[model samples]
Target chain A: MTWDILNIIGTIAFAISGAFIAREVNYDLLGGYVLGFTTAFGGGLVRNLLIEIPIELIWSQDYLFGIAFLGITIAFFMPDNWIGHLKKWVIFFDAIGLAAFAIQGADYAVSIQAPLIAVIVAAVMTGAGGGLIRDVFAGRKPMIFHSEIYALWAAFAGFMIGLDLMRGPYATLFLLIVIVIFRMISVHFKWNLPHKK
Target chain B: MTWDILNIIGTIAFAISGAFIAREVNYDLLGGYVLGFTTAFGGGLVRNLLIEIPIELIWSQDYLFGIAFLGITIAFFMPDNWIGHLKKWVIFFDAIGLAAFAIQGADYAVSIQAPLIAVIVAAVMTGAGGGLIRDVFAGRKPMIFHSEIYALWAAFAGFMIGLDLMRGPYATLFLLIVIVIFRMISVHFKWNLPHKK
Candidate 1:
């Protein structure tokens, strides 16, 4: 997928999840919006600060307002089953976002001559940062703590993007797609790492 | 008026506000602690970042566990009406905190040889940043935008502290006291800039 399309999907998916969680927690409209915006873009903000992106647009209100609209609109029409039946859908889209954004972040950081480690870190952050933040805002332990595969998936995507070993944009796109599918399958099947759960 | 005393007060006041505001919003125990810690120490996080301070403390279980205790203890024992009645008292101490931290911020920046304007901005932020973040986390426009003369009052104190002429510590402390009293009076009398409303 083109990066633009992927980004918009990622952003909207994030916004929706934040809205859904806010509803579960009974946040007010503005609070729901705040949660949405932070969930959608907090990773980007963290990346910018760490990677030296300008802070102006990040701090501005465009993305914030967009997420607020999404949250309120969702709340206005949501059914009781939306929360329970939608868990898998949220996770699937979330994995897609993680892969795409991780590649994007690694590319941007590497383009700026960031160290390899920094590239990996920034990539994983751009991918998983929003989810981590949403959990924090919702007062829940982050999925990253419970799910090891999520970060590792982002790292794999980031590694390919940063190393520039991929042949073309299609190759990079395929790498991201593989990571996304791999993560979804891993999560669905209850894959575990060496550490204790 | 010593910096240490002011620092302690600012931390405690912001922490209390965090706890109180979360309770007002009907947050659970963990949520209350999260809000309080974010309000009390978030500005210091930004301040440290601006000056390249490490951010490890924000995530330490020790800090988290401590803040949780601090908040839950207040929530457990304090009567619901207690904080509401102590609103004025909280504001008074908070103003002192603002003045103290603002000065501390400017002094630190100046010591690090940041530009004058940068130092000035840092001072203003250190004064109000915690409250601003608290507002964001709590889903409201920050109280600084309300009829409080708090930020400017802190700036005035910071100016005196970072004064190039080098006054005695006692003089700086006296200025902080003056700003605190002035701020309390302003808030009590509904004093505000005429054009703002």
Candidate 2:
């Protein structure tokens, strides 16, 4: 039940983010919908592909798709002033989405008995892959590659899960909180990975 | 035997094209190799995921990976003058790759009993998907969306194949030649789809 709720939150947050980007890029309604859907699900789609999950399985998540669609539609119709008011909240929601998706990805990998490295990769991919793809489609630089520290938190969660350091009912919730807090702190401090000169 | 040969030709051509783009973008050797490999295989990877092929099957194609690596290394080491001289030939090879991969993708979809629309999509995705991804990674608009009428040829091939209008021993060969010639002609004539203003 908790997993389902987290998934819904992540999907809605990503969809709104993607729709906002589409608006910024002057895309039409259809383009906005496409981008929104891709942003919500593209990460999981890529992860499933890597882990050998059937595409049919992904298609079965009709409720998630519906939620993403609703979020994008709402974002599309939102006025500029409303968007301005929500701008700060978007980041918080995005952090929540990131944490939830990252933990879910790690858990999935652990369930599949994937190696430690694979689990870390899966977490990063599931958490940030959608945004990476969304930026590519928008012809912008991928944020994860050059922005404030983000995917690292997902990798950290994956490492913890892979090592069996975090378990039990509250363990996931605790890790989610840690990742969300860390991501916000990094953003606030403008933390970034060192780039090669 | 024929399929294997076509696959090799396609892989080498794509790897060279990708490496050249990496050079144009001033990426390092590692980036060049990454782009080269992705350009050669990313389309098929996407197609496999869409069609529900297992990831293990893709990993089993070790020889194709080897060919792509070799091609990229050669491109990386080639003199700038040599690249300039070979620039004209790249398009021709790219057309061959597009035709071969498009046909291969359509064939795979048909084998899996996918619907006609799905088969057409598979063809276009396999033919143009890698280049689309490469352009995206390089932070450029996807060429297929705005460039000369390239993917249309792949779609044509798919339509023919899906409708079973082209079949028999020499059918694939015939379709391949037609797609290549049409692609070259389109490029030479600067044919393009009408875009929305």
Worst 10 residues of 2 chain B by lDDT: B188-197
For candidate 2, write residues A1-197 as lDDT tens digits.
Answer: 98788778888989999888877876556456657877888888788778765555565676787788789888987887789988778888888899998888889899989999989988898898889888888787888999899889989988999999999869889999999999999999999899986
lDDT by residue (A1-197, candidate 1, tens digit) is 38767777777777777777666655544345545766677787788788986544353435444644665457424776666787777788778888888888888788789988888888888888877877766656787878657888888777776777764788888887898889988888888666763
Q: How many Å off is the CA of A135 in candidate 1?
A: 1.3
Q: Please give, as one word, the docking class of candidate 1.
A: incorrect
Q: What residue pairs are clashing in model 2?
A: none
- Candidate 1, which segments miss by more than 4 Å at Cα? A57-68, A75-77, B1-197
Model 2, residue B22: distance off in Å is: 10
The positional error of residue A33 in candidate 2, measured at the CA in angstroms, is 4.4
Candidate 1 chain B: worst-modelled 10 consecutive residues by lDDT: B188-197
Model 1 pairs in collision: none
* Model 1 chain A poorest 10 in a row by lDDT: A55-64
lDDT of 1: 0.70
TM-score per candidate: 0.57, 0.61
